[model samples]
Target: MDWIVITVLFFILGLSAILIIGTLVSLPQVGDERKNLIKMKAQSYTFAVAMGYVLIQLFKNIYNGSNEGINPFTFLITISIIYLISLLFFRKKYGS
Candidate 1:
């Protein structure tokens, strides 16, 4: 695989990590039906966003040059940016 594809994969994985972490951190402490529903919604949204990021990156890799062996920190920063953008756009739509 090209470096660009590798970089995009890194970003997608990082985004997925962020989503899972976010859901874990935000989950309510209480246990009940309401909490269960809330947790499911959070998980669903996180999964959806993560998948979207991966799909988007797959397309981007087609035209971009390979970006092999890029720094993790750089990949993380880009992941954060994409996560924030998705949050901003989806927050209202999902009413989270």
Candidate 2:
């Protein structure tokens, strides 16, 4: 397998895992108002970044080569799972 592929997978998995774990573990210690703020900020940023990635992928596909890379489906799935878990964890804590 390509080292680039390995590196990308590791990067995505490590960051998503850390974010999910940190959010879940810290929820109990955060106040309700702060939790709400955190949730809003996280969800918005996650969505924005994910969308930006999708747009980049779109253009990459259209451009063909020069910046060729792996399909982003895996990244999308990882992002969705992490963001969903974060939202659920926050809702459970904040009574949303």
Candidate 3:
């Protein structure tokens, strides 16, 4: 990967981490109903972002004719990171 792409990816990941941490920190102060609503919205947003990222990668691969299949490790890591982040948010909000 190019240096610019890597840099941008890191920037995005950092922003994501900040957002997740901020949400987690604030979740406890909210009421239960509001917290559940926020959790649902957060999960939907995370899913959308992850799907968009994967689709972008797929398109790039098609354009570049890189037959090297998607790395399972990277795919799993991306998904698991998103899952864990949302899980943290849910746990903090709902005590689950």
Predicted candidate 3 versus true structure: per-residue lDDT over 2-44, tens digit per residue: 8886676666666666766666666655477766776776678
Give the lowest summed-lDDT range of ten residues in model 3: 71-80
Q: Per-residue lDDT for 26 in model 1? A: 59
TM-score of every candidate relative to the true structure? 0.40, 0.49, 0.47
Better candidate number, 1 or 3, judged by TM-score: 3
Candidate 1 minimal-lDDT segment of 10 residues: 87-96
> What lDDT is reached at residue 36 by model 2?
65
RMSD of each: 8.4, 6.8, 7.2
Query: What local distance difference test score does each model get?
Result: 0.58, 0.70, 0.68
- Candidate 3 residue spans exceeding 4 A from truth: 1-32, 83-96
- Evaluated against the true structure, the overall lDDT of model 2 is 0.70
Clashes of 1: 5
Question: What lDDT does model 1 reach?
Answer: 0.58
Clashing pairs in 2: none
